[model samples]
Target: MEHMEQYSITIDGRTLTAWEGQTIMEAAHDAGIYVPHLCYLRGLVPFGSCRVCTVKADGRFVSACTQPVTPKMTIENDSEELLDLRRSLIEMLFVEGNHFCMFCEKSGNCELQAIAYRLGISAPRHDYQFPERRLDASHPDIFLDMNRCILCARCVRASRDLDGKGCFDFVGRGRGRRIAVNAEARLSDTVVDVTDEAIDVCPVGAILKKRVGFKVPIGRRTYDLEPIGSDLEARRRPRAAAPTGGAS
Candidate 1:
């Protein structure tokens, strides 16, 4: 295999190296630069559905998860305009769904909630839809709460690509769109299991494992100690060098 040439691009005035054919999100993540996103998992194909990873590059706003990084490209991610856009998007997600993080099991571990905290969104700026949604607890080991779904399709892709089960999919168009199991009758009739990757990749509290609610305790969950981008920022720090020339 031929070695891909590496080049550098400037993001927020910081020069970061990236390889050819790599998307801006991929390059940024590999360089340990945090770019807030949903509907984009590391190993999964970029869906670009959420539009939360939007960043301005050379005066044009583009989805960082899908746009390829080019040499000499100047990307702007921390500007006030971008921050406001992100906040508005987060707020929209809040109102579109019945998050109710206070009572949800995935509250502390939810990426959506963490992103909301990171963007300083104390409340939804938009009107709440309060759509009447349903919950499916037919499965013995897993359940689905349609109310909390952001329709990011993480589970859809995970089930299709990773699990090879094609157990889940989106049914309906536009306002009526939603995640549906293959059986369509009930979750208990499907082949999905508790160990499926789809059960774990949900950004919101839509899909969850059963019988383990509140196991970690409140205020002691994944994002309770640190915000979403904290780990990415920590990854950006330089590591200590290993001792050389064997034991002295």
Candidate 2:
């Protein structure tokens, strides 16, 4: 396929050009506009459920990842209206489930945590729905905690696309919906390969290394990188591991 040419786009009255076929977020990132995002990963397809990256393009608040650019498209990435919308979305994420970042192992290194900080959401404005969930520490290398999962599906995609192992899937719907390993089976027994890619693909600490916990401090953590794309690309490196035991 031919390389797509750069096209002009006006976001927040600033006109800039970006390569065709790149998502709105990619274009904005190239133009030095940081769109608040949580579910977006560099090497995977954009799943916009987190809604923090919504931008007002052509008078509609659409996800920058799912929405492609068009000629003469004007977007408002940081207007007061969209900022309020983003704040509300971040608040929803905080109250939807157990996102206790302060206690999470991936607090400083988490995308959701970073976006929540960027949105200035000090605390959840809505009621907290702390549902009961079981933690899966059966895997020798990693721990799968349902409590911190926001159903971003980045790990699922990483398993399928990058690792060639479709190990993760969303089981149930709405409040009942959670990422399950191996068609509702245990993570240790899943036929899919659980490489370092699977672990790093997670936006939160839902899937974490078993032995290594909080080795890096908050301020010196990986999220300190200016553009998240470079960090994400670096994390996608697949590390060699011994044969994993049965799925948990």
Candidate 3:
């Protein structure tokens, strides 16, 4: 078999090697560089709905999650301009929905909250749009709270692509957009299970598993001990030597 050619790109002055077909975000993650994102899951298709991953590549701003890397390409991810853009996006999400992270079950483990914290967004700059969204608790083991949704479509993609069940989809348009189950009836009538990838793919508290709220307790959840990008930082760090013999 012939070997595929590997090339390098310069991201924020750091040269990193990348494969031919890999996107900028994928290459950055593989190189232990954290690029903030909401809709770009590792296995799922890059939805690029959330513009949080926007970065300047070769002086052109583009969604890093969907933009492929080219050799010697100049990608600026950590620039002040890009960081401000990400912060603004996070802030917009906060105001667009009723994301009361303090009272939500997915607070600490929520990707939206984690990203907001990472971007230093203490509050939304824009006025809150506390739209009157509905909550569907008819499901036996799950709850769908539209108020907290960011419309990232992670659930929609996961349901259609991974679950083999087109149970979820985006309905309406613009400010009226929402996720709708195929049943068109109550959520209990739908075929979605608690174990569905769609449930796991939700970035916020919009879709939650019932009867397990506060199970881990506050200040002890996923992002409690460390920030969202801490894992990437750890991966970038050099590993210490292992002792040849048993512990002293």
- Could you give candidate 3's per-residue lDDT for residues 1-248 as a string of tens digits? 23444667888898877766678887787777899999888878888899999999999989988888788899999989999999999999898889887688898999999998888888889999889999999999999999998888998899999998888888899888888888966788888999999999988999999988999977789999898988986776222122111111
Candidate 2 pairs with clashing backbones:
186-247, 186-248, 187-247, 187-248, 188-246, 188-247, 188-248, 189-246, 189-247
TM-score of each: 0.93, 0.86, 0.93
Tens-digit lDDT string for candidate 2 (115-158) = 76666778877898878887988777779888888888888888
Q: Where's the lowest-lDDT run of ten residues in candidate 1?
A: 239-248
lDDT per residue, candidate 1, 1-248, as tens digits? 34565667888988877777778887777667789998988877788888899999888999998888778889998889998999999898889888898799998999999999998889887999999999999999898999999989899999999999988898999889988889958888989999999999998889989988999987899999999978878877332122111111
Per-model C-alpha RMSD = 5.8, 8.0, 6.5
Q: List candidate 2 segments past 4 Å from native.
A: 1-5, 192-194, 224-248
What is the Cα-based TM-score of model 2? 0.86
> What are the lDDT figures for the candidates, one per model?
0.84, 0.74, 0.85
Question: Which lDDT value does model 1 have at 92?
Answer: 88
